[model samples]
Target chain A: MKARVHISLKTGVHDPQGKAIRNALSGLGFAGLGEVRQGKLIELELDETDPDTAREAVDRMCRGLLANPVIETYHIDLEA
Target chain B: MKARVHISLKTGVHDPQGKAIRNALSGLGFAGLGEVRQGKLIELELDETDPDTAREAVDRMCRGLLANPVIETYHIDLEA
Candidate 1:
């Protein structure tokens, strides 16, 4: 199975990296841009065949190591 | 419109960050895991309303600034 975790900072939290990117884009002549937010995408390969089990494991993985629960949120996608 | 850019290292390029994540997962007792890869997701809020124009601008953004043509690949999704 394959699992993908999308981890992103909470909306209220400041994102300096995203701000830098937006500024860079503006400097490069890209106009009318609003907010630019950046996040992390983690792709995992798992041996489990069952979708439920795979999702559960990946959820655990996100909670344990992939994300900071207090300031970040994560979504998991599983494929078999 | 909204634009999302997903940037990832091309296959065959070394991924030390990914390897470190895989090792950490193993340390956390996540077994039966295969390759783990990491990527970047950038979300943009655009003011343009036309789909074609929005997409074109974002494509330019990816090619010119958001992605490294050398070893990184990027996919853009625009929403209105």
Candidate 2:
């Protein structure tokens, strides 16, 4: 099975990297762009065949190590 | 309008960051995980009201600055 996890900083958390990207975009003449928030996408190929089990394992992975629960939130997408 | 750009390394490109993350996951006891790939997700809030215009601008942003055409490919998603 394959799964993708999108991890993003929760709203209200300061994102310096995103701010830097926004500034860079403005400098490059993209003035119309508004707030930019950057996040991480982790694509995982799992050995497990069961979709339910795979989803649960990836969810655990996100909570255990992939994301910082306090400031980051993650969404999991299972491949059909 | 809102747009999202997902930038990922093309197959055959070396991904040191992804390797490091994979190693870290294994160290932390996530052994069932297979080949792991890491990518970037950039979320943008645009001043443009039209979805089509916002998508085009974001696509240009990806090609011109956000993603490397050689190793990275980007997909743009426009919110309704």
Candidate 3:
């Protein structure tokens, strides 16, 4: 099974990297762009066959190291 | 409008970060894991209302700065 984790900053948290990207876009002539937020995507290939177990393990991975719960939120997608 | 860009490394490219994460997961006791790949998710808010325009602009952003085309591939998702 495979699990994909999408991690993004909480709504109220400031994202300096996003701001830099937004500015870069404008400088590159993409002036129509507005605000930008940056996040992470982690794709994991697991030996486990059960979707439930894989998701649970990946969820633990997210809470433990992949994300900072205070400022970021993560969602997991399991694939066979 | 909003556009989400998913940037991932091309197959066969070495990813030290992914390896490190995988090692860390094992250290944390998630030993059932196999391979892990990490990527970036960039969310953009655009001023354009037309989906076509927004996607085109975001696509340009991806080609220009959001992704390195040589070793990475990116997909854009446009949202109203």
Candidate 4:
């Protein structure tokens, strides 16, 4: 299976990288850009046999490796 | 409009972060997990009047700020 995992900083967490990008945009004359939130996208291939197994495996991957539970939230999309 | 910008390292460019993530997953007992490619996702609220304008704005943002064209590729998703 193929999975796309999106991991993002939880709301209320300050994102310096996102802010830096926003600032760069403003510097480049992109006005009226309200706010920017940056996250991580991970595309991976897994050998899980089924969607259920893939979900469980992906979730574990997110919690154990793909994300930092203290500050990040994650979602997964599985494609065969 | 709301836009999602995804920025990723170009192929052949080494991604240490992605490699670290893959290693972490393996360490956590996620076997059969193949290679991992990591990218950045930036969600922004913009004041563009239309999708075309938004696309133009985002492309500029990506080129002038959100992405390093030398090493990264970017895609945009616009929502009204």
TM-score for all models, in order of appearance = 0.96, 0.95, 0.96, 0.91
Model 4 residue runs over 4 Å out of place are none
lDDT of 4 by residue, A1-80 (tens): 88988888998999998898788888877898988999999988887769998999889888876789999999898999
Ignoring the other chain, what TM-score does chain B have in each prediction? 0.94, 0.93, 0.96, 0.95
- Model 2 regions more than 4 Å off: none
Instruction: Give one digit per residue, the lDDT tens place, for model 2 in A1-80.
Output: 88988999999999998999899899989878788999999988889888998888898888888899999999999996
TM-score value, chain A, candidate 3:
0.95
Model 3, span B7-46: residue lDDT tens? 9999999999999999998988888778899999999888
Ranked by lDDT from best down, the candidates are 1, 3, 2, 4
| Candidate 2 C-alpha lDDT tens digits along B16-78 | 888888898899888777788999999998999988888888887898889999999888988
Regions more than 4 Å wrong, model 1: none
TM-score (C-alpha) between model 4 and the true structure: 0.91
CA lDDT of A41 in candidate 1? 87
Q: What is candidate 4's lDDT per residue for B33-68, written digit by digit as tens?
A: 877899999999898768998899889888877789
DockQ of each: 0.89, 0.83, 0.89, 0.80
- What is the per-residue lDDT of model 1 for residues B1-80, given as tens digits with 9 covering 90 to 100? 88878888999989899999999999999999999999998989999999999989988998999899899998888777
User: Candidate 4 DockQ category?
Assistant: medium
TM-score value, chain A, candidate 1: 0.96
Q: For model 3, give the TM-score of chain B.
A: 0.96
| Fnat of candidate 2 | 0.86
lDDT winner: 1
